[model samples]
Target chain A: MNTFTLGLVVVIYLLLTAYLGYVGFRQTKTSEDYLLGGRTTHPFIMAISYGAAFISTSAIVGFGGVAAVYGMGLIWLTFLNILFGIFIAFIVFGRRTRRLGRRLNAHTFPEFMGKRFGSRGIQTFIAAVIFIAMPLYAAVVLIGGARFIESIFAIDFNVALTFFTVIIAAYVIAGGLKGMMYIDALQGGIMFLCMLFILVMTYVKLGGVMGAHQALENMAELVPEGLRMKGHQGWTSYPAWGSEWWWTLTTGIILGVGIGALAQPQLVVRFMTVKSGRELNRAVLVGGIFILVVTGFIYTAGALSNVFFHRQTGQLAIEAAGGNVDRIIPLFLNSAMPAWFVYLFMLALLSAAMSTLSSQFHTMGSALGHDLLGTLFPKTRTNGMVITRLAVIFGIVVSMVIGYKLPGGIVARGTAIFFGVCAAAFLPAYIGGLFWPRTTATAVKWSIATGIVASLFMLVFMHGSESAPLGICKALFGRDVLVEQFPWMLVDPIIIALPLAGAVLIAVSLLTKHESALDV
Target chain B: MFGINSCGIWLGYLLAVLSVLLCVWYGAKKWNKDDDSAADDNWDSAETQLNENL
Candidate 1:
């Protein structure tokens, strides 16, 4: 907790990050190198960078807090992350993405889609969506990192936010994807080791694994009165089937994030960074283990923190953190671990935030500069690197402004909203483009358009979780939600829009003429 | 199995462990396989055309 020690640790970490950024900058010789790391990234680096970029403060701090409240049932997300995010994503999606990206000479996700279907309009539309929606996600991550730094360093939030933004911007602009990957690998390693240490230390503090879990189950009677009414079961157990809690856990958090990861622009581009399917295959081994330790342990540690709090203060984790779920993990860390580990965990968190932010900035930059502007104004294509670097700065500035402007509650929903929107908007077309050769460009256009429109509509009107907070429905319809009925209000936007979009795509593709002879 | 009583929660934990194993096995089996070369020849000219257009 010493200011001098904390300052020294941060300085060393930043200095190391700068060195990696410089390495990436020196290696980038062409636009291809800046955009896709020249298609020769190492498997270990690719996998770790992908995993680190995929996870953020949202997973560790935000979702970890949710686990403290929701219990180990959140582990289903971990299982799904490995099953879908790593296994299917790498083997099924990653292989095809690399092949198709190379075949089309596409550097960005939007460009891949645009070239695959031979429609620059499709490319521009997807890029526009990324530019508009991604800043919200970037802003929330910015705020999360800044808030943590504010709490730990006793600095102004503005100072923390600017420091975090500048560090990420420097690396991403100078090094591009290649530089970002190197930093991501380092950050990922710190995160994996720190999370492992916390998991082991937590279990040790609370008897052992089984003992800790059993202790949690024994305190089932202490479930908050309000939560029990909504089908709150013990922490170690799944929520009651068909209960409100079950729907929220299953459909909202688990399905929203778990399945939504496949189509992420930032994550997808990592697949295109490597040379061949062999590298992707090799990456799966490392990515699976990385996700398991980082995600699995945090969710487990979050749930088990209840036992520690209960033993120490006779209060649940939520109560111990004064009912703010966000504080539970930090409170547990400060209380349960030794002082030095807290500082190390802080570094892991900074790594988490920076890794994710770097990718977000890079993706946003490419979307605006490479995909949208470069396509629409052909002359801008000549200065692609300059345009992209300036776009990264624009993204950082937009995100920073939004970080200051947006209310606190909406920032918490930012990850879910962005993930759900991306899945609904991109997943159907992404799958069709990758696997189904019969898929028409017209079908992709409609599917993508429907996905974006329907998801946003659902968020604004029907899905109570987002709709209530957004207050647009209340302002317009004079009601909290468009539907006063049960479950409709509870459902996540992804559940409705993703299927509708897919159905539209399939139905339309069947009826329309096949436009391209290109086969996957 | 791990002192968690719920069958569903236990299944989740088991599946998560199983998934990691699956990735390891698949990766090891296919580590050196080059599956893209056959397709690379077909796309060579198309890739060239696309690059020129850009």
Candidate 2:
């Protein structure tokens, strides 16, 4: 817990991280190895790496703090993370994606989609969307990491942001996917062990598991007056079914991340990194368990932070975190965790943040260099690795700008917004492209455009949380929302746009002449 | 009908447990099955089969 000990531990972590990067760099001679680890990665490594990349500091620092405010209802998001994110992602999608990636020799998400549909336009459009939209997701991830570093290290925010960003960028740019996955496996292990300790220790800090829930139930009246007006029952409870808070929790967080997990271009491409359907099949249980433990423990511990805060400061966790929901987990650790564990958990949180950031940066770089620039200038194919490394630097700089400018409490919202947009924009075409041979490339184009337009319109005009600032109505009419109608502003864009995206894909596919499913 | 109370939160926990169970059940079945149909025996040959034979 002392400076000397903390310094020593961090050095050890850095040494190990560098060793993995070195091994990855050495083994990665060709572009293929850099991108997919020669397609021979161990299943356990793949599973843990997948889970770690999928659940980052956003789950821990950002959304965990929201758990402090919203209570156990956030657990459904965990359920969705496992059921949809891990279960279906690996079992349903991973098998076919791996098979097809080998079939078509596609290395990136846009490449995979473009090759699947046999459309250069589809590939270019996807590449452009990912290059543009992915940075926002990456920025929120960067912010989540920087926030934890800033809070715990007691450093200036910008300094912490730079420190974390530079560290992650060094390895990701140098070692590529091989380095990222190897590092992810290590970080995933640290996260698993630390979360297990946090769960047990938090219950001890409270009276016991059952007793903690009781104490929380007894403090229902302590729910913030604002949240209570919105239908909060207690720190241990869900909101009333149809309340404003319920809609936000259910539609925004749960559905946004739950169903939205399926369409994430980063996660989707992870399916292709393995050699065989058997490897992906073997990874399902390991990935599910990893996701369940990491997400389950964090959500549970985050909800219990309220009880811990009340015992410590006679205040709710959100209030004690100084009004930023993102700060709740960091502040709670400082107050509740043992001193030695505090330093150790710093590494765990770093693992949570860095593992995710590395993957996001990798995805952004691939989207830019391999998908966009590579698509534009096919002659630069020989310089693929150099182009990707350059894009990684660009992605990091763009991420740092947003990390600095983004308002507080936007971490979780930013993550969900991107996820929801992807669900609406990419999910329908992705699903149809995988399953239905009748899915025409032209139909998928319409689906993608519809998804992007509809989701953005709803987010800007109808969704209450984000609509205030960027909504069309606010911009045009100087009013809050386009419609003064009831509950129109209450629902998140995923609910509105996802169905429309799916419908468009179906309608266009049904009317069009089909090609061979494997024509690509 | 739903309230953020002890029972509701516990219900979420129960659902999470059920999901893990379902995942395990499905994963166990998938693991036990033989996937020889998609084995990575011959890399370029597999690509050729996929491109034309399939």
Candidate 3:
């Protein structure tokens, strides 16, 4: 790549972001405008912004790389993303979130829950969880983006991470959610085409789709000995049913992310941004299509990259690319793409990274400032904008510290932990609150608390893929799990905690039905 | 075991295409979907005191 061309592309991107930030700052007169776009965002912008924030570097570079190592089994996530992330989210959860939020005049996700359930404790607790857990997610996105930049620009990882953070943090602090959505929409468009190009070009390089899958399937004999020990069927097919691989794929990636998307505070807020039910309804197609292309292509291209690597270098994508799963996509592009194509692709990855990072920081800031602090101080609600801005800076500092400390190969699983935790802790109450009018505040409160406690307990002491690095089970119990080969240890927390959460909520709601507040 | 065939390989993308069509189809059918904008306006934001009421 020509240095001038690369520098020019970045300069243009930076300038455009600055202009977008300037526009957002001017438009944000009230906290309503700043936080929720004054509830008048168009459907196209809302859908694109939601999709962009929903699918970031984690989906493209992180999960895509995982697909390269694990084969196309990760594609199930794409199908589920459309079904749950788009359809169920926009049609089911989003409608109630928007309706109830506007009805309650709630501005933040926790505030929505707090108001709907009529409990300040609910707001504070969930806000605390976001402030504490969200940094890990932010760090993984930072690492994923920085790693890609480091690979291409030949810069130190710290420098790349810092550089990425500074640009996004500045814009997010100035623009808020309105500013973030505009940038997200722009970046989402860039990501759409770039991902499309990557898929088409990759398939073209390795013949066509069928030819590529056939080629990948042909390499099944080359499955690593270590993986084969744990029920490694070839990459293209689903893992052997009931095998460890199947457990990992079905529980960790597919169910973890698919269901998790519905409960995200950041995504839930986007539904309330637009004007009316019809506006949100109109967004269904746009969000679905954007997710289909960006997520669908990345997973597909990731799986097929092994074919390119094997045919060229006679090694699996991971081993030949220095064993860093995160580096597979970058390495694949460097080896196979033209300099110009690589240059454009870097911008797409940058867009993907920035779009999500800004959303994470913004949401975390709102959680701390608008929900937690606002509940405690209440006076801060008068100057909520200032508090939220300060909280954004605090979020960036925490994420930076985590980004610096994080080890390699933590990208995909790191993202999954945040998603799984959110699903386990938040999903039950959120759904119950929306659909079941009989869902009591006492039940919601207990359901959320117990769900979070159980999820945390499971994550720390169990041997699921996300918590595999925690080493708590091994250090304390001298084994991966307490009970040898426990099925619970292999699956993510949602499988256990979600059911438990529902049961607790249902059981408690029924027990308290005679004294229910809704009846009053 | 589906044997890593093209169906297992291609099912996601095919389903994704179907999902897009379904969303678009449903969205078009509901283009005149019932307006819930009245609810937002009916509840005044200036001084509702929903917070205190809670």
Candidate 4:
């Protein structure tokens, strides 16, 4: 597509998002309106908003790139995304969360946790963790969208990042959750259409399924001796059973992203926007179908792109785009897609990036403005609107700086780090508070504290490249750090930390007696 | 691009199975008309007590 047409499509989409923000600004009269859409969002809008926020450019770019490298095994992640992320998330978690949120009269995720458990301290601590950790994820998402724009349009990387940051921040700060949801619904629609078109076009370009597979199968015979030895025989087959690659595929990509959806604060807060359980139930199908298409199409096309690119060039798309796997989707779209589809695809990419970014910035700003500081100084009584707007600006600035400094793929990994932390810190408390009658404030606090401490210690001292310099894990364990030496450490912290946190919650609640001294 | 690949066919079948299961679950939950005498008894007695009081 010509630069002018592509830019025009993006500009029109931005204007539509801004118009939605304007509508939200007029409708919003109270802090509750700003935070939870006046507790009256419709099922369709709610479902799309939740789905859009749940699947960002990270899914399309980062994981798609990973698929280009790893092959069709990543499709399991897509299946789990629908079954767990959408289906179970909406029916099991969404209904209960909406009911409890309404009962507690909570606006934000931290507020919901705090009010449900009757602990101001728990709320503040969760807000603190969110504010501290979420920027990493937000920055990674920013990188994914900006990198795509830079690759397609040849714009400067920092310029693209800054433009995206400002556009998202404006709508979220001005319009709030209602505006975010409206734009999300629109973005969600565009994303669905774009994915469907890309998939069909890719199939047609490859001359149908049988022809394409035969070509890929023939090409598989030419796999480099080195890659064949490493177990990459072809892009046509699943990885060998019980291989190290298979484990990473199943655990890290599939289970990690799928299970991590349960504890995402930005997504959970969407449940609080609707009026009743019935509304959430109605949204279940809409949400599931949306995820089934967006995620399913993305993964299917990503896997198929292997054949198209490999047949044309001797290398996988990821290698064709240098060593950076995240660039594969953008490279394929720019080079292989029809010119007009490229224009539409830009809108899809914009929708994915902006929808998720607005929600992240809103969630981060609220966590900082409402929960953390509001708890420490009970008498402040500042207007939430003003405070939230300022916090949005603060969040945008911090995320942009991080986006500028970090490499694209590293930013993607950083997003996984935050999701893991949220699962560790909040999942037990969230699940227990909803189901267990005897869950206490003390247990909630202890569980959160332990989960946060363990995850942070591991992330800093064990997971990344600078592990040796940090060395907190080494100091504690008298070792070179288990995560670096063992592949299992890469994906094992959540298994250990989540159970430990849950055990603390259960044991502590059982051990301590209530202050009222009432019979159980 | 793998047009008639078995992988594609398997994926299609998997999706079809998923859709059918979802339909069956929703249909059974929404349309099932089995009687529950114990719950009915509780409701009948409660109605009777209210009528007597009136």
Model 1: CA > 4 A from native: B45-54
Candidate 4's displacement at residue A520, Å, is: 16
lDDT of 2: 0.83
Question: Candidate 1 A-chain TM?
Answer: 0.99
lDDT of 4 by residue, A131-167 (tens): 8888878888888888877877899988988887888
Collision count for each candidate, in order: 0, 4, 0, 5
Candidate 2 vs candidate 4: the TM-score winner is 2
Ranking by lDDT: 1, 3, 2, 4
- Which candidate model has the greater lDDT, 1 or 3? 1
TM-score of each: 0.97, 0.93, 0.93, 0.87
Off by over 4 Å in 3: A464-468, A513-520, B1-7, B35-54
Q: Which digits, one per residue and each the tens of the lDDT, describe model 1 over residues A289-387?
A: 999999999999999999999999999999999999989999999999999988888899999999999999999999999998899999998888999
Measured on C-alpha atoms, candidate 4 has an lDDT of: 0.75
Q: Report DockQ per prediction, comma-separated.
A: 0.72, 0.41, 0.44, 0.12
Candidate 4, position A104, lDDT: 63
Runs off by more than 4 Å, candidate 4: A210-233, A461-480, A483-486, A514-520, B1-54
Q: All candidates' lDDT scores? A: 0.92, 0.83, 0.84, 0.75
Whose DockQ is higher: candidate 3's or candidate 4's? Answer: 3
- Give residue B7's error in model 1 in angstroms: 0.6
Q: By the lDDT metric, which is better: model 1 or model 2?
A: 1
